[model samples]
Target chain A: MISAVSAPDPDVYLMLRVRDGDEDCFGVLLDKHRNSLVHFLYRMVQDQPVSEELAQEVFLRIYRSRASYEPTARFTTWMFRIATHLALNWLRDQKNARSEERLDEQWEVADRKPSVEQRMVYQARLQEIRDAIASLPDKQRAAVLMHKYQEMEYSQIALVLESSESAVKSLLFRAYETLRARLAHMVTGGTR
Target chain B: MNCPLLSEQTSDVLLDYSAGRLDAARATTLQKHVLVCDACSAFLAGQAEVWAALDTWKAPPVSISFNRRLWQKLRFRIWKSAVPVAAAALIIMIGFVYDHKSQKSQMEIDQVERTLDDIQLLRQFDVARAL
Candidate 1:
């Protein structure tokens, strides 16, 4: 039950309408969250096509489960919960799969940079960051992505990860600590 | 104001400060403490750099056909589900037609039998008349 003090979430209202057979509401929810959801999955899997497929699966699952959806938490929390599960499962399945990002794709995006030298440096640094993040333990990766990128509250992340808030915090700290060690060179003046 | 780095809970305070989630009052307190606490200040600076580096990795824009692809998949799933029901209905109709045809054939055989019996009775009556 929603506490009396908390204002009703607009997404939850939209979801409830979806529960009541409002197809338009589902579209609205999808339009609002599709990019973030896909981005989260993309970061998790480190593969765009796989992430896109997983995102579609996530929405498909949501659409499938609309009949039974309850306003138990924020719509995004629930959505990410499902997304995290799918991403984790995919990662587990592809445990031995290469974790490399397609550099050409990054180059395409990096083309917006002013000079070839600047683009090359940016690409190299971006690759390092991606590798550092991809090197984290799967759970830690999920936690950090949710905390850092999604800007999800620790409690919401816990709900998504099905762990306690403290555990989530610990996961994030460890993940960041690993990242800091790996990417310390990026810090200003090269030493933190 | 004990050093936030000394314990797990306090370390999280450091994280909150870096993330800007700390309240203004606590933020001021931490900021003042950081001026003298090299450990906390270094931790915050490192975290700041990490945050900045992370910000550079923007997510790729979502595909334009994402919704269309999803709707197509949904439509296919619906049709996939309907295929079995349609097959079942077809099977039931075939069974009913077969049963009805079998019943009609039985009635035709019964009519044929009655006609042969009538022929036999008349032949017997004609033989009786000849005797």
Candidate 2:
């Protein structure tokens, strides 16, 4: 059971409604979280199709388990915990045979006309960044993605990763340290 | 202010500062320290660069059919689970019919046996009267 907080979370409320067979509430939850969840999975696995498939599975699992849904934590925390589990399991299964094809997949930004040189430069930088992220250990990769991209707080990330807050901090530190070493050439003295 | 890099536990202060998660007062303190502290300065600069580079890797927009496909899969799952139940119900109905037919056939056989017994008794009585 979720300990009572000062204010109830709206998503948790929606989930409770879903538990009571409110189909529309499920759709609301899906609309609210679909993009972020897909993006998170995309970053984790670096494959669009796989990410989308996994996100679908996540939502399906949630829907299937709605009968027993309990507001034990923040909705996103529970959602991301399931996502992180799937992403990690996928990475583990594909170890030593990771795909680089999706790394070269064109992003939406590439749709705008750009000079050939600029496009080349953009693709090169993107590849370097992706490779650096992909090079990290699976756990560290997950930690950095949640921390840097998702902007999840340490406690929330800890909950997702099933670790203590300090451990999460340590993971983020080490992961960032590795990224810093790998991408140090891109620094132009600009503020973050 | 003590440098955040001096200890493992406090190292995330630098990260928090870089990520803009530090409070205003602490951010100001870290900014001042970054000016004088080369290590923190370099760390912040590199982290910033990493963040900028990561920003370039935009996640592809989710497919337009994502929700549709998901709903389809869900419907399929419902069908998958329903198939077993439907089969069980059909089997139960078949069993009920088979049991009813067997009982009817047994009653018919009992009636035929009674008729044969009565015929044999009548034949034996006729023979006794002839004697």
Candidate 3:
């Protein structure tokens, strides 16, 4: 169990150790942040394998830039900034490549026992939410994911996205409004 | 669907409220206002559901070999990057050594030239005295 009395930011300390030639500290940092980073990339790009690849690239970048790592911000902020930049570039590349080849690979669904009808409904709803999120503009999508999944503060989201707190708030507001318009039926049982 | 009681700024306020970013005093005030404003209340409710549905969405766990694979790639990249740096340093070191040797030889050549000049001047004086 983690203690409530917050210790000094372990990620920063570990990063400093990494800067000082501790290869093991890099492993520790990767283990600590791998899930969150991968999940963020997965949500950003909507592709699991690509997410994994990009997450590895993000870590590689961190290792490469370790010599210049400064504790000016929370380690996660700097880390996510790198992840966001990579994910956005990947998205842009996908966009450019879309004209040449359609990336319509089917994602693997989770294995669970349910009535076929029930599974169909669940999968349909899940797809709807995923499509809605994927439809958001890149920056707004990033802001929403960082805020919702990461439980990051508006300030932290700003830091990751390189925007002001007010701008982050604005992005969240607009993103949620669009989501609300699309998914409100799920809540209110109203017609779309 | 703008409510009469809420203005455009209310959207920002409502988002902040739902995100738990509003302070206690403002949150309490918004809570009181939300009770009376059905449209804003419904909007807030929908946003809450969006949050809930998003929370339900989880990524599959990374493979167990993720760490091992990442470390391997990272090590390879570090070494690959070091090669160029090492080569550049080697080049710079060689350049510095060559420059130092050239400077020393140039100084020695100048000293020899000065010595020859001195020898020529002395020989001239001796020749003049003999004449």
- Return the interface RMSD of model 2: 1.6
**How do these models rank on TM-score, best leading?**
1, 2, 3
Of the candidates numbered 1 and 3, which has the greater TM-score value?
1
Please state the Cα-based DockQ of model 3 relative to the true two-chain complex. Answer: 0.28
TM-score of each: 0.86, 0.86, 0.74
lDDT of 1 by residue, A92-175 (tens): 999899865665565556546447676677677888889998899999999989888888878788888888888887888888
Per-residue lDDT over B55-87 for candidate 1, one digit per residue giving the tens place of the 0 to 100 score? 888777788999999989978987998999999
Give candidate 2's root-mean-square deviation (CA, Å). Answer: 3.7
lDDT of 1 at B91: 100
Across B1-131, the per-residue lDDT of candidate 2 in tens digits comes to 45558355677888888788999999998888889998778777888888877877789888999888988988899899999999999999999999999999999999999999999999999999999
Residue A3, model 3: Cα distance from true site in angstroms = 26
Q: Clashing residue pairs in candidate 1, if any?
A: none
lDDT of 3 by residue, B1-131 (tens): 56853443347677678878889999999899888888889888888888766755667777788888987887787799799999999999999999999999999999999999999999999999999
Regions of candidate 2 where Cα sits further than 4 Å from its true position:
A1-7, A103-107, A187-192, B105-131
What pairs collide in candidate 2?
none
lDDT of 3 by residue, A1-192 (tens): 122113467888999999999989998888889999998998888887788999998998888888988777788888999999999999988964422211223223345556666655655666778878988999999998998788787778888888787788778878888898887676455221
Cα-based lDDT at residue A95, candidate 1 = 88
DockQ, per model, reads 0.52, 0.57, 0.28
Root-mean-square deviation (CA) per prediction: 3.4, 3.7, 8.4
